[model samples]
Target: MTAPIVTRDEPVAGTPMLDARLVVDRGAFRLDLALRISAGEVVALLGPNGAGKTTALRTLAGLTPLHDGYVTLDGQDLDRPDLSRWTATERRPIGVVFQDYLLFPHLTALDNVAFGPRRHGLDRQRARAVASDWLGRMGLAEHARRKPRQLSGGQAQRVALARALAVNPALLLLDEPLAALDARTRLDTRAQLQRHLAAHPGATLLVTHDPLDALVLADRLVIVEQGRVVQEGDAATITAQPRTDYVARLVGLNLHRGRADGHTVRVNADFSLTSGDRHDGEVFVAYPPSAVALYPRRPDGSPRNVWPATITGIQRHGDNLRVQLGGPIDVVADITPAAAAHLHLGAGQPLWAAVKATETRVYPAAPGGSHPE
Candidate 1:
């Protein structure tokens, strides 16, 4: 952390948000999720497209009904399918910021924000005052008079956020809040949004596909895959130990499904690697791309994970070059540009790659679950 560039007051006390199970059936697409987000805390729902992230958000916001299970906030039953207890979207104490922002083009920034408070029963003057305060908090006070089209991408995003926060809801839902911005705008806007989310006293559920956004903005991550809770943990914990291949790829790790016994895991029918961490039954072996070393020949030493691969792709990765390979296990290797040049690396080139046993991590896939090789 470079001499902390920003500071925010501690979040205020608000009603603790949701602790619920959400189940919805949309024909073949069914979502079965269990989530708990604390007050004054931000949780990011991260997963692949159509992974039920948005569906869960909609359920929380009361836009979608539950097919089974229930939703509760601060012990208040929002939905109880078994009991037939349901709350309307407007009746739920929740605020939502949609992916496209959905700002009213006819209204100015201030009015857009005021719209929420106004709808919540605040008088015109009081609602405008609240909206003004939120705009100031978002650093968009001056843009308050501008319409959605008149504001820049970052400014519009801020206004949209302001609108959502103006209601002072117990739970805030943001669906791809920064997705509308460009790369440059996203960088700056992300920082700004982080500050506001930190100041929010209510629980926040952020839905995003970008790993950096989820890692930076949320206190915990709930990863759903194929409408199921695949993984859940803090950013650092999940980043360190990704249980699913989708999560491994999101965190930029080379992962393979395998069966483990002692320190060795058989990743494939013809391939097995020694791992420092011991596990039993079905397991996964993962290592960072940087852990891989390439050689022109089978320069073998003690690295147990060595394989012959053909370069399938090549691309610039930050200050280094990322070489993609196809073989027993498709893997990516990150090496310095100088080393790449020395090796004359290119697509279709055959090379040997190795990773020391200690560099790989092995963990049980699931306890008591069917062990799939």
Candidate 2:
């Protein structure tokens, strides 16, 4: 489903500080996206690889030219092909933090953070003072003398963020800001990033593939696929009602779309499942992997949603086993280790998968209309 894009002429109150509809064309691929971020808000751009997330970010940062459409920040047009208006990257009041941190290898942390303010016309002493304050805020004051090579990954990330913020940018762009950190460091840095983002007065755009980062750091989410927006909303709303398989998987739900007749949804010619919620017309049925129960034998319980399937794969998911099954329907089921042992779960083993009708959530499939191919 495509999310609605608020137009510039729309009489909406509290217009977003960052408003843009980016359209860039390559030989075989095109990027068309509408994005808006209010002041003091963090919006996460999430999508699969090659979904044009980077293209959109680059276009907004003036690193890439817009094929059409416009990029407007705080009522000022940054890029407008139709109006022949464009702002150079260095001239725009924007800061960018690359995935690699992109710190100057030879410069000390203090000088690295001081670079942006200096480029923005600050004197050497004034820029260093601002950079020092930012480093202190990031809890990296003591590491100011260390070069990029001497700093830890998390410390380098903080230094990069300090540099980005030192210029007092009007818009901040972060591309996979924490993707390079280890799991433990990522967790700590994510929390720190959330605090810093909350304190920033300008709009911020975060691009990342990790759903956890998006869920934890963003005020809203914009999910794209194949160069078009598929969904956009608050984390809770998107998590509970995913519109596509990609989004469903991101939220850890097994989703299937089909014709809904009362409480039953016909996923395909050979498969139909019952749901607790009732809806007519096209609908999507979703249930978590944990909601599925697996059995070596056909379950002889009430008229529950049950199907015979064969194990396609199995992997450890935390303390549980995640089993992928293939039959009339392909699905993933989470079972305890004890249950896995009891069922002798293995690849190619036949099993029965059952889910309670009440566990399934049903919603209209085309609530927001279709998205681009």
The lDDT per prediction is 0.87, 0.90
Task: Give the residue spans of candidate 2 off by over 4 A.
Answer: 1-13, 368-373
Give candidate 1's TM-score: 0.91
lDDT of 2 by residue, 34-58 (tens): 9989988999999999999999999
> In model 1, which regions exceed 4 Å deviation?
1-16, 367-373
Q: What is the total number of backbone clashes in candidate 1?
A: 0
RMSD per candidate (Å) reads: 5.9, 5.3
C-alpha lDDT (0 to 100) for residue 310 of candidate 2: 96
Give the number of the best model, judged by lDDT: 2
Residue 136 in candidate 2, Cα distance off native in Å = 1.2
Model 1 vs truth, CA RMSD: 5.9
Q: What is the TM-score of each candidate against the true structure?
A: 0.91, 0.94
Q: List the residue pairs that clash in candidate 2.
A: none
